[model samples]
Target: MYRIFIKPTLILAAIAFAASFALSHVNKITRGKIEERARQQKEDALKAVLPPYLGYTIVEKNRKATVEGIEFFYSIAQKNEGEKILKAYVFECENPGYSGIVRSIVAVDEKLTLLGMSVIQQAETPGLGARSKEMASNKTFFEVFFGLSRKAASDKEAVSQSWFEAQFTGLDAGKKIGIIKKGEWSAENAALRQELIDHNAVSAITGATITTKAVILSIEKGIAALKHVLEQENNAPGEAASP
Candidate 1:
């Protein structure tokens, strides 16, 4: 009985230990690559969301602050021209979505005007909530299906800006932004897109209102935290307030 039972138990234990060790080794080997990919994704998101200027510098890199017990990370970008300097603040925000957390990078100016937003991470359902990160392709279905436009597409530089994210550009971040259930946005429909922008609203992804709201709510909370931090900084002794 000891040989049959105890020996099998020991064998199983050894297998489990070996598996765990192998997994640890694999993780160690790939950890740096994973981190590097994540960093690149964040850097791309920051560039996509930041307000356009002739050229800009990252004045503050990965600054951290806590407001009301919630920690926030942000970066400041500056563009200087002659005697004037323009600045933009980019904040990373995450909120629970239908399937998982939706993380985004949002940029705003000194007057609380939203410059842009880019969804950096999300696990929402495909063809629905996942469309939040989908870009409106300029190619027609036939061109894509037949690979007729491959050369043209490859020649042109790819842009990460998505229709859902583009709606947030030039919005009033200090106030509530609205969402409407008017079909998905199309890049070719300039009139309809402009109409949505004029109303300070974004067209919600079909059948994914929860994910849409999650992104908006995250941005709002992040802006609030940033406002608190800025206010504190401005009030600090000998600190010049942001203009």
Candidate 2:
């Protein structure tokens, strides 16, 4: 009895250790590539939202703050028309959602007009809350926000680029943004939807009210946190240095 039970337990322990070691080794090997891909994806998302600019500078790295356990990041876009004027300000934040944390980024012009928004990470229910992702054309929410470009010239084309995310553009951080679900949305009636758009209201995904609010809250919190930074930088423009 001892031989039979003890032998199997030892074998299982050895197998578990071997598997753990192998997984750890593989993770170490691929860590660099994974980080590179993530960095590239974020760079792409930042560029997708900001207006045409010569370049960008990261003013602050991503870090969690004590206030409400929120993590935030910030950047500044640059234009080359003449002196390198600060084109726009970009920021990111993570907030809790139905399934897990939802990460997002928002851009705004120097005058405080929203440029665009993109969902960086989420773990919500698939086909519902997960629809918040900002994927390439033909694979994201409504295809209005698809395609990876700085700007779309035509109104129709611009509307399609991350339609939901794009709606956040032209909005101001000072306003109290609201949510509108599809059950009440009149997609067929352009006028009704336009009204919602005009009022800083986000059109919610059917059956995903919680996730929609998560996005809204994340944006709001990001704006609040970023405002502190923006105010400080503006008040002390010479002290701040770009990353």
On lDDT, the candidate that comes out on top is 1
lDDT of 2 at 203: 78
For each candidate in the order shown, give its overall lDDT on alpha carbons. 0.86, 0.69
TM-score of each: 0.88, 0.70
Instruction: Please give the TM-score that candidate 2 achieves against the real structure.
Output: 0.70
Candidate 1 lDDT for residue 24: 100
Residue-wise C-alpha lDDT for candidate 2, range 114-190, written one tens digit per residue? 78778878899997787665322433344546655334335334433455566676676668888776443323556
lDDT of residue 36 for candidate 2:
97
- The root-mean-square deviation over C-alpha atoms between each candidate and the true structure, in angstroms, is 2.7, 7.1
Estimate, for each residue in 142-166, the C-alpha lDDT of model 1 and write its tens digit: 9878988876565334667788898
